[model samples]
Target: MTIVVVFIIVLIPAGMVFFFHHQNKLKLRARLMREAVRNHEFTFHLPVKGLFYGEKALQEALNDLGQDINKLVAQKEVESWQKLTRVLTHEIMNVSTPIQSISQAYLEHPKVVGTSLEKGVRAINDAAGNLVTFVDSYRKLTQLQEPVISTLRLKDFLEGIMELYHNITWEIGIPADTVLDTDGSLLRQVIVNIIKNAAEAGAKNIECTWRDSALRISNDGTPIPAEVRRDIFIPFYTTKSTGTGIGLALSRQIMTMLGGLLELSEKADAGYHATFILKFEQ
Candidate 1:
C-alpha cells in the first residue's frame, strides 16, 4: 500500500510536468502569433503536433487564417496594379490609335507617297502599332479568366513535368498522395515558369516538396543577386536582355487571382541557391 501511494505521487507529478511543458509550447505559439500580428506579419505558422484536440484545431484555424490574410494582402496589391494598368493602357491605346491612324493617312496621301515623308510616316505607323500590341499583351495581366478550381494530384503533376523536362534531374520529396486544389492549367503554367527560371539560372538538379501548406521548390543554381530580389515580382522588371520582364510578375498576379500568394523564400535548403514558395489561402 505504501509503494502504491509513492508510485501515484511520482506518476502524478511526472504527468503534470509533461502537461505543463506541452502547454508552454502551445502558449509560445500564441505569443509568437500575437507578436507577429503586432508587427504586420501574417504568414507565421506553428506546427499543430503535441497539442490537445482543441488546441490543435485552434492552431490549424489560426494557421489557415494567417495564410488567408497574407493572400488577401497580395490579392489587393495585384488588383491595384490591375487598376493602374487598365488606366494606363486605356490612355496609351487612345493616344497610339490616333497616332497610328494619322501616320497611315499620311502614307496614303499622294503628297507624301513615294517620298521621304512616306518613309517617316511608315516608321511612325509601325512604332505606334507596336506600342498598341505591347499594351494589348499586357492586358493578360488583368484579364485572366476565373480559375476553374480542380484537384490536382501532386504526384501526377510532377511526373508529367519530369517527363516533359527530362534533361534535368529532379528530386521530389513529398507524399505521393499529396494533392492541391487549384486551377490545374494556371497553376501548371506558374510552376513551369519557375522550372524554366531555375534552368535559366543554371540549375541542373531541382528539388520540390510541400511544407506548411505551401509548395516549396528549390534548385541548385546561381543565387539571385540581392539587388534585384525585391523587384522580381514587379511588372516590367528583368535582368535578361531578351526577357519580357513579366514572368515572375505575371506568375505572382496569377497566384493572387487564384487566392494564393507567391514568394521567394529567404531560407534556402542545403545545396540550393534559392527557394520559391507557392502558398494557398486555405
Candidate 2:
C-alpha cells in the first residue's frame, strides 16, 4: 500500500510538469508562426516532425495561401498591361491614319509647284511631325531603364527638392535619420511629377511625410472627384486641357518595376484635400 501511495504522489507531480511543458511548447510555436507571417516571411521553414498536428496543418494552409496570392497578382498584372497596350494602339492609329491619308492626298493633288493649298499642306506636315514627336515621348513609358538603387537619406533629398519650387510653401514632416533603399534619380522623377501637378492645381501648401517605409505627399488643392479617381491611373487618361496623361501612369509603372507601389489615398487631413502615397517593399 505504501509503495502504491509513493508512486501515485510521484506520478501526479510528473504529469503536471509534462502538461505545462507541452502547453508552453505549443504557445511558443504559435507565437513564432504569427511573427513569421506578420513579417511577410511566408516562406519560413519549419520541421514537419517537431510540430504538433495543429501547427503542421497551419503551415500547410499558409503555403497554399502564399502560392495562391502570387498567382493572382501575376494574373492581374498581365491583364492590366494588356489593357494599357490596347489604349496605346488606339491612340497611335488615330493619329497615324489621318497623317498618312492627308500627306498622300497632298502628293497626288495636281495643284502645281506652289499655291494656297501648298501652305495648307505644309501646315499639315508640320502638325503631323509634332504628333510624331508626342508619340515618341509616350514610348518612353515602356523603355524605362532599370533603376540604380542605393540607400538615400530622406530629409536631405526633400530639402534639395524643395529648392526647385520656391513659389510654393512646404510642410515637411520626414523623421531624421529616416533612410530608404531606392533609386534616387527615378524616385525624384516620380516626386517631381506629383509636386508639379499639385502646384498646377493651385495648391499653396504641400506636405511631405513618411511612415513605415511609405512616403506621403499631401496637397491643399481640390480633391479629385470620385468619378475621375478610378480612371486616373489608366495610361493616357486625364482631365486637364493640356495634360499628357502619362505622368502619373509612368510614375506607377516605375514604382511597380521597383517592387513597390504608388497610389492615391482617399483620406485627407485638415486643410489638405489630396494625398499621394508611395509604399516600398521591405
Q: Against the true structure, what is every candidate's RMSD?
A: 4.6, 9.3
**48, model 2: CA deviation in Å?**
31
TM agreement with the true structure for every prediction: 0.76, 0.66
Q: Which residue pairs clash in candidate 1?
A: none
| Per-residue lDDT of model 1, residues 150-240, tens digit only | 8888878987887867878999898989988889888887889899998888989989998867889899888998778867877777889
How far residue 102's Cα lies from its native spot in candidate 2, in Å, is 9.7
User: CA shift at 167, candidate 1, in angstroms?
Assistant: 3.2
Q: Give the poorly placed runs of model 2, Cα more than 4 Å off.
A: 1-79, 82-113
Question: All candidates' lDDT scores?
Answer: 0.85, 0.77
Task: Give the alpha carbon lDDT tens digit for every residue of 143-222 in model 2.
Answer: 78899989989989988999999999998898879998889999998899999988888888999889756799999986
| Winning candidate number (TM-score) | 1
